[model samples]
Target: MIIVIDALNRHRFKGLLDEMHRLRARVFCDRLGWDVMVRNGREVDEFDALDPAHVVCLDADGDVVGCMRLLQTTGPHMLADVFHGLLDGEPPLRSSRIWEATRFCVDTKKLNGGKTRNSISYVTSEVMIAAFEYAREAGVLDAVAVIDPVMNRVMCRSANAPYDYLGTPKPMGKVTAMAALMDCSEERIQAIRDFADIRHDVFLTEDEAEALFRSNREAPAQRTAPPAPFPESKTEKADQMPKLPRAPHSNALQQYCYEQVLNAKSQSDVDAAQALIEALSDALGTTSAAELARLARVEAQATRKSVLVAAK
Candidate 1:
């Protein structure tokens, strides 16, 4: 499964982000030897502080198996600031619709199978799809990536070839970097999906992902006694009961949907937004909060009554 984490929601996925950073440390610093900074076994840099959206893919065990970072071109991104050498003395291409993708990696040790669904190849396609689709939905037009030669070839072989290149390859120590541009188009997404034969949706709703993470939290391999400082008390048995997860997206999504429906200026707009909320109700299979639903009905009825009085 794939989850897009950015500044708005990164706090909710700290553990997942930690695992992703550690995976980056292993891939970029240890294996590929990219001369990245690894502090406390996590490969993070100044770019990470910029609140880029991290497209992270998780294995079946909920461990981060793949990840890539997306940063807007208007800001201080790697290509413009750190990788200007690849721009060939040209001003860094900066546009609101363009985003820079960097630090793409997958856990090869765990996803060792060849081109199968659970393999590295398939996961790579999924990550690319997530990044492009997510960015496109957010109004991104093209993505520039500072990638090694190996990734460039992999993209070509996997039907994700870049449509253009910015400059000649520049050797950055052991790794030679080249800037490649890929469009965030439906055709591009579909072609990658075709190459990987992946038909299912790659994204998980926040609630669904939270439930999965709750279930996937690892348990102790062997039963162990409580630590000496924290001795078990008589009521500890009750406290140890597995906690139930709160319903996902019911409160927040329902309120937002109802707001969209009720606050619409025209009846047609109201109907359209109401239809969306109904569809969400079916998809999530969760009812809105009782009080909020009651309040929405009351307000809706009042709006209709006012409209009738005005017409009469």
Candidate 2:
């Protein structure tokens, strides 16, 4: 199996889009039964602008076996509109800290690498490697997916994915799943690429996938198998995550600024807010009690919202 991780050009993009629609029609509209919109055997949506989109391919003997779509979470992305209903509300997308991962599919017909490949392992490894490259190029700090609970475990175990539960796995026509975010990191991404090594056919045969599954199963017990690295602490993640800075604030705008501070993404924002609060408190040391209470109210409201969102 060969992995192609390129942004689809005009002709290539159209061809790929056609191929995607064909595959979707076969699996979704015809076999399992879904009501996806299609015209002349193609799936086209407003989102397919050829920008903020990526396509990954698994070519075996010139035949496409697997494919996935990636989208960035800029303004008007799925996370804020269509997919937002899948989760509690919109995740922190405005800070440009995370991207959305979606439209993942594998050709079951070509899975297990046909008869030539040793086992199902080859196909699985190819998929993993392609996914990591997609994540890196797309600047995806996190990936959100609505997938089967069983497959969710496979993602966590085989791909070293870190996730948080969003909702109960519900049936979407034939697919039963819930949404979750896979935390992206350099270490986990590298491990996937190393295991995939598509330059050689080593990871694409059936025997390899079986071995991978077996080894993964016994990985916790096997001293030689490296465990997934521990994730950074919440505070550390918050520090790394970017924050949307405040615009100029007037007396009326000061309340809004205080609210935004509570929703801060990094420690710097929190520290700044703390400093401002201290300065204001000191200045109010000789002021009337009424004025001090008004200032406290602004800070308190902002802090409450920020903490609540972070906890979720």
lDDT of 2 by residue, 1-312 (tens): 333333443343344445655765665566556566777776555656635444444332223455555566666665566655556553635536566666556566655543233234445555556565557665667766556766676666555555585645556556675767766676776665555443432222222222222332333333343332212233553354333233221122133223334355455555554444343332223332233344344545555677889899
Worst 10 residues of 2 by lDDT: 244-253
- List the candidate 2 regions with Cα displacement exceeding 4 Å: 1-8, 89-92, 113-121, 167-171, 193-312
- Which residue pairs clash within candidate 1? none
Q: Can you write out model 1's per-residue Cα lDDT over 1-312, one digit (the tens) per residue? A: 789999988888988889899999999988988878999999999999998999998754456899999999998999899989998999999998999999999999989778886799999999999999999999999999998888999999999999999978999899898999999999999999999987878887665455344434632221142311211232443244222233333333333444453455555555555444443442324444333334345545656766898999
Candidate 2 Cα deviation (angstroms), residue 280: 67
Per-model CA lDDT versus the true structure? 0.76, 0.49
Best by lDDT: 1
Residue runs of model 1 more than 4 Å from their true location after superposition: 222-312
TM-score of 1: 0.71
